[model samples]
Target chain A: MRVALDILIWVLFAFVIIGAIPVAAGAYQFLLIPFHSFKNHYSKARPHLPRVAVLLPAWNEGAVIGNSIERLVKLSYPAGRLRIYVVDDASTDDTPDVVLGKAAKYPGMVFHLRRQKGGEGKAHTLNHGITHLLADDWMEALLIMDADVIYREDSLRRMTSHLGDPKVGAVTAYIAEGSADPNYLTRFIAFEYVAAQKASRRAQNVLGALACLAGGAQLHSRENLLAIGGRIDTSSLAEDTFTTFNTQLGGRKVVFEPHAVVLAEEPGSIGALWKQRLRWARGNVQLTQRFHKVWFRPSKVHRLGSISFGLFWFTTFLLPVAMILSSIGLIGLYFLERELASTVFRVSWFLSACTYVFLTLYTIFLDGPTGRRSWREALLFPGIISLLVMIMAFAPGSLDHWLPGLFGLQVTEVGQEIWTLSVYAWLSLSMVAAWLVKKVESTRIGRMLSPLLIYFVGYGALLCAITFDSYIKEFQGAAQVWDKTEKTGRVAA
Target chain B: MSGVHRPGVVRAERVTGVSALTGLDQAELSQGEATDRALTDEALWREIAHNRRAELRLVPEALLALLVVAGLIILREVYFR
Candidate 1:
């Protein structure tokens, strides 16, 4: 009975941690500088005649869906062969009209439809489209996308050809900046995305563990998708991620084609980005519960990577809270052995210095070849990477209304009001206290420390570690999920 | 992992072959649906067997066994090592 109980706990632990792979992946991609050049090999490559459709999911996105449709219909592939379908979820806006305009211009090239009554969300809308597709008789593969995602003419062709490999279940395309003008946050996200979509996901494909396809530009077989379920969960906000991993559950692969690039707008404001991240975080916490059993299957190498994904974040999420309290205790001990305090500070500074230098070199290399950042920008990469995560952790409402969605039906949890500001008032206050103490304490070590360390050590270091571990895991095909930090970008084009 | 259900059911045995394949990797092409049966005669099966004989090499499990041992050692250190 005791042995059985131990096994049960192990299984439970495995399930909880497996989905954590993606979160750690985001962090990993952020930290690691890649040595290899990332480019599209499939852009110019053709494949044996494979039927493909560009399936677009739109939700009240009248403003941008037209641009997306016009852009998609103009793709350079064989006009008669390639298909486009846009399914609009119940929209109060002129979204349907915009889709209809494009449908009229392209005639057979673009297919437009509205969601049926009782449709819950994007997932339901997609399900309706998948079932309602006229080309089901001819279409072999489906390219799932959002309303806002605009693909280059060659993007569709490159993504579809990769699906020819039986081991590859889905292909997620890379996101590049579409417009030249971008805010600092958007540029940061774009560069961050390139690092992830290329450096990390490619490495995962090398190992056969490519994680989830990006919702913006995912390509897969109609048969494989139908096998999972006809549609994503419209009831929830994170249909893309849910659908991606669920496909893996059916014994299919998820991949990234970095060269099949799509340009997307970044979220405009930090607050807007935060709300987007919350949706992702809630979805991830929810999915972690959904796919808990996948980890216990002994035959799958994915289970191992999945667990590492979770463990890394669980450490990060739990560690900062633990470390801050521990540091307080350590400081009290400093009275007894201030020498230990001296040593600890010195070690931290040395580690921080070494890590920053290593990261700067990688950024310089990436910047030199691709003009990813200006010289001054690349020079500030490490400081910004750490500073951003630290401030983000203390950002309002991050963990405010997570429990209800996170715990699902087992716990009756409630989400926060839209635009609920000041959610992190208390946590931020706590952070301020830690910072003040470290600042005022004229003790040997605290005096030498920078205010930046409080931000980095208390928050950024933990997130950086989490991102690194996940990026490596996902790059290697681990399906574990970390939340996407939704920038102020529209999903509909 | 299981019994073969039928010739083209569990794994679709490629019947028709594209005589001159395009950018599709040749190794993956055998799994594609070809309309012609005579194209996939015994010789092609033998070819697929040669190409698909092995999978990506995996690290030996012995290292994993040692990791488990090290985990045990670490646990012991925390308790009674």
Candidate 2:
């Protein structure tokens, strides 16, 4: 019995180490980001403008479609070379009428492609337009974008120029959450984009393995599109990611153009954000299973199967699992060997604290305007309580000393032990808090409380909770329904 | 290429008499020529120079961030100990 207990303890430690690996890998990815300036594909890119077709998939986007069409017409690309194809997905709104009006105003430049049957999903809608565009040779390159995204004047031109390199398959722009008056949720999203797109994508560029192209701003060369079955993958919820992987697997480079900016309206409330992110999280789960054979098996054809890429992918996909496992490990250790558990907890969280500080600071430095706007969200990304835990982890008795003093109470041994145990359980407890944040958003008093709950639980934790929910849904074989994030024309150029 | 006849595509009015390959008409040929002229070797070099400058600017900022992180680690080790 003693020997068996010892082995169980060792296994718990192994789980803790497993959880720490991803955090270290994430920091390592950030370290590689600075190397992007040296190891980018800029030299091979030249000034080349192909005849571009902008495919806009619309489903009840009448409120934003007119303005979107107007913006496309005013883009800084050559008017003769650019054409807008609004693929109306049988929208019951005034989308068709608005698009037809634009088509009349900008003849030959703006075309309305109506689909009689609709609600199939974005991929099917895109494929409809793709079939029409590929039938003729007029479209040398295709730009697939959402109806509500406002592209910067030179964004398309920059994306097209990258296609000058025949070796390059696709280009994706940095999508910034540009709600005219951003609330707490949008601010968090803005910071998240800064970290995900501006920092992580740059790192991926250096590593030469992009995970996904932005759905709002993906530009693909005609030859490359045709090479990958002449249509978008309608099988997965993450069609953009499917296309991205297929493009790279077929031996062509997919580049992220940071200079090319596109503004998009993100979910403003917790309930809305949950629905939108659940779809994405579920899509990622599907993609992981679909490409199970490809992980960690390096291929000469593509880097999708490379060890670094696989680590990045699996770490993100299984982060919630890692968190739960790590918490279990620490708590088990505390029961069996208290002193060792304390030592391990301190060492592990010290590394986590260091990583959090460096990553948050470096992300702020990545984009000037976004950094300025969302710096507070970036700082409190892990939540106020988690940040305190980080501080306590590294500086062992500091919180115990200061927190009790702040409350004007003496810290007893029993209180200290309870606090220690609570800290150990916080890794998993944070996710519970995050789950409550979503639940609270739907209540009568939730509108007032949800935003406050998000701050206390942390947006990162909320995302992790959603991902955890995705695992449950996928396990139960829940029906994959495409939930459209409703957009109010909140984005300004 | 002359007209739209695809299934489910209700309305598409395409401009005819233009080269499908080049996508330029007779009237727009001058405009295309001007665009081509603007994309000269010198212009390409100028853009490259701007990009290089931007990239060079990042090196110091990254180094500074690393230094600050290093300082933080030192503070934790010294003061917390």
Candidate 3:
């Protein structure tokens, strides 16, 4: 009982430490931004708006690029001042043909460029555009955008206004769901976007630890970008994170301008949304590993301000541990020691409830006064999904093998390939366990939680096996890459 | 580098020696130059060689890092104790 009590107190202390980080994060919404907003007002005392380049990277956007370009071109900036560069990454469709057609319509307004045929993907395309195409002196401000995104006409002006302050490296405008009538999956994700952008992005900005600017539509200076590195890490799957980290590494502040808004379309169907989010999660996992060196050993300039990037994804792997602890707290409450169990149960519930509330409120706060989210709606997000959504998002896909293969090799193989013989053993036990545990909550839930213990920790162990076994591989030292999600939802009338 | 405006009426800005790709004078390369140059199919692009190391650009991302460290320190001091 004495040893158990000691362990119990230690566990509670761990929970408090874990919960406090985000609570400190939440303090940003209530306290930091308002203060920073005022500081921004003061910085405006001497303004210097550089000529801005709205760089929208697109491939096969024939249907939407026209409108997206027109909307951006018509932005309130001086007529020719706001230039639009759309990198056509070797699309098989009439993307280049369509772009040529638009270039005729908006003669000097829209600039059309193409990537080398075999050398495709956003990072390579961006690197090619920035280095070979543009003379560094001229490309002052750059806006990174997906092909399907649309933006307010005044968006450029507001973003440029902030650039006048030399300290601001990158500015991310508010990204909202372009289609309200999107599928249910899209709707839930849309709310999540608003919450994420407002609460998490806002909190991150306050803490000065912004990991990446949104890829949809964000503005940065060319000179400043080149100073750190021209086009962010082209090798990493997550170019957005690479840019965000580099921007912070440059010691330039990244800001979220709520007033500056853009409408970006997201995947509408379940299959499509899964692909989209999986790419995001996997890309996050990949980038976290790639930039772990920078994040873990951040230079003096951006020590704490930069950790949130790694922290966000790194902590995700810990969610399962936290949930298991919660389960333990409940089990202890039920059978162990009534008083001690009550304490553990109440304490766990309180810490978790507080985290849930604060995270929800921070997101709702980003909704501004007219946000669609209510206190209740935000409260039951994960619970209402009944953990199915959690499994869908977290469960490692069979497709992870394809990811490393995309760079041209299967050498650094993990789990599936590495544990082939071990897998046979585990497979037999898993099948038996599945048959026995059908009535218990869910098998998918088990898959979700099981991988947390495995994902980074297990993936790492498997990679070590590959190296030790001298596994034959492809793409020797090339960066492992993943596919960008195709946005299927179209703008409906 | 994907957003490209459709090629409408190709209007060269009646200049002597500008890029024939767009033919527009003072056509900043960031928009057309980068896109137009990326037309090659087999060029092996090198990642930015690390010749430059945070050479004190206008805004230092380092200050942001320092701010983060300072913030962490403050958090630990205030709460961990």
Report the number of the highest-TM-score candidate: 2
On residues B1-81, what C-alpha lDDT tens digit does candidate 2 reach at each position? 233322212111122432222433434434455554443434543564566456555566677777887898888779888
Cα lDDT of model 2 by residue, A1-493, tens digit: 9999999999999888887887898898888888877888777766566678999999999999999999988776667778999999999999999999999999989999999999999999999999999988778789999999999877887777678778899999999999999999999999999889988998899889999999999999888999999999887789999999999999999999888899999999988998998889889999999988889999998989988889899899999999988899999999998988888888889898888988888888888788898888888888888889889987877896888899899978888788888888888999999888788788889889887777878898999999999999999999888899999899978
Quantify all predictions' global Cα lDDT against the true fold: 0.50, 0.85, 0.51
State the TM-score of the second chain for every model: 0.29, 0.48, 0.30
Candidate 1 residues lying further than 4 Å off, grouped into runs, are A1-49, A116-119, A234-236, A295-298, A301-337, A359-493, B1-81
Clashes of each: 29, 0, 49
lDDT of 1 by residue, A1-493 (tens): 9787556544433432332333344335433212112222232222423556778877667767788888876664445445788887766778788888888888877887777562365566677778876333556677778777678766775565556566556778877645446654454455456445554565555444445567777777766776776666654456777777677766777766655678887664433444454455455555555666654343363432454344433453343344343344334334434455334433332333333333334433332333345343333434443333222333222333343457662322223321121221222233444435344434556544533343333323323333333334434654433233332335333
- Candidate 2's docking class is incorrect
Candidate 1 vs candidate 3: which has greater lDDT? 3
Q: Tens-digit lDDT track for model 3 on A82-193?
A: 5677788877777788778878888866788887572356777776667653464445677778878878765655565556566777788778776746543445556677
Task: Rank the models by TM-score, top first.
Answer: 2, 3, 1
Cα lDDT, model 1, residue B50: 29
Error of 1 at A155 (Å): 1.4
Off by over 4 Å in 2: B1-45
